[model samples]
Target: MKSKLSWFSVPYVIWMAIVVVVPILIMAVYSVTTAEGALTGENFVGMGDYAGVFLRSFRLAIIATLVCLLIGYPVSYWMAKEGLRFQRVAMALIMLPMWMNFLLRTYSWMSILENHGLLNQFFQKVGIIGLYNSLTGQSIEYFTMLRTPGAVVLGMVYNYLPFMILPIYSVILKLDVSLLEAAQDLGASGAQVFRKVILPLSLPGVLSGVTMVFVPSVSTFAISRLLGGGTQMMLGDLIEQQFLGGAYNPHLGAAISMVMMVIVVVCMAVMNHFGEGEEQAVML
Candidate 1:
């Protein structure tokens, strides 16, 4: 049995080596070497020049994650508390956007948010923009949502909000009803039951959702390119520019990727550390 199981693991091991380990090893080597194949630290050293880009990427990712949390948590909780048919319908609606091509969905957002796009046109037709102009003493024709940092964040939130909702909803839905009953029997109010019981128990899902949302948001290139109009350059854009765009520097791109991987790993580790401590405290 052991021999057979070990034989079965061989295929997976080979797959991991080819797909994951080999690429990482190659990236590590490239990150530390120049185009001439000479080892150098300049790749990492030059990252300081793009500190503002790094900060902006993180700031936007954080905001998007927070917005997803604020919106998704309530929706998840509501879905979990609803009837089975309602939950199914809500889940279908939530997942409907994901069935479409990712780029198509983002492109649709571009159309909706452009200067004379559907949203502004509707607002103008309804006199909402005029009402705002009257109140603010200005003659702005179109709301400038596109080609801005907020547009990038909006794209991130729209694309990744489902990731946040699914994990949290699954966690909340699986919670034992008896636990809530016991809490209530012990004189806990509705808010207290949630704060003390549901909130603590559901934190793992929140952590998972945050990781899912933040990682992609931080590294997203297409959304920033389309929505930010090249104004907001995230790490992904910078890396792409080095490797694929006019910069054409694979070593620097690898260095940026490695550094980003390290930073994300460290941030996630720290976040998990605190989350675990909180979970443990709740357990105690």
Candidate 2:
């Protein structure tokens, strides 16, 4: 018998079209269409903004993604493989920061990282460094910390680490113990078992976590605004500038957003391809 729910799908499809497809269509059109009253080739500008975004935001996103992987993988693996009660505690702790408002979290980092801030104070108390007489003292260069690229990466990591952790944890938790035992039975060393068995088995999680962390971290504007300031401009900040900072160029903003979307899609595709290859190799 034929399914009778075809009519029920219409409302959901229409909602998706209105919410997702329509905006994307508008953005695609805006990316190609020029601004009114502007000079020739001024509005869309083709791939120029995309190139600029690559040069500006690509490096920061890569760095942030790498840092998240480095930090998140170990935490996820440990929690999944070991620490039962502590795993819950760790997950709770990871998510606790998120419970607070995101802006507040970013601002909190500002206070901690500021030269004369609590971090420096704690360091001074521990005799790691001397107390700063001023916020700009040689020992406490808060201004540098406030508006720097490093801060941008730090903020991104702090904000998006949970995304990396959750996916990897899910994978790690579901990993077959038999595979690890079999590797051990075959005389594989600890490192060998991890490298050959655990790592390969966990590839799906790694891919998911990386994509989740990388895409949003790259596009996030709030962290950069609060932490990086004028010195470190990411694609999101640049797009915001076009929309809100007296530029009022929705056409340009749309073009940039479309480019960002393309980059995210391409990166995800490449990662997925690699992940599939790894999965195939593991299966073989």
Report, for every candidate in turn, its global Cα lDDT versus the true structure.
0.94, 0.82
Model 2 Cα lDDT, one tens digit per residue, 141-160: 32346678899999999999
Q: Give the alpha carbon lDDT tens digit for every residue of 1-284 in model 1.
A: 99999999999999999999999999999999999999999999998998998899899999999999999999999999999999999999999999999999999999999999999999999999999999999999999999999999999999999999999999899888999999999999999999999998889889989999999999999999999999988999999999899999999999999998999999999999979975575455
Candidate 2 residue pairs that clash: none
How much is the lDDT of residue 110 in candidate 1? 96
lDDT of 2 at 275: 95
Candidate 1, pairs of clashing residues: none
List candidate 2 segments past 4 Å from native: 1-11, 37-41, 44-53, 131-143, 277-284
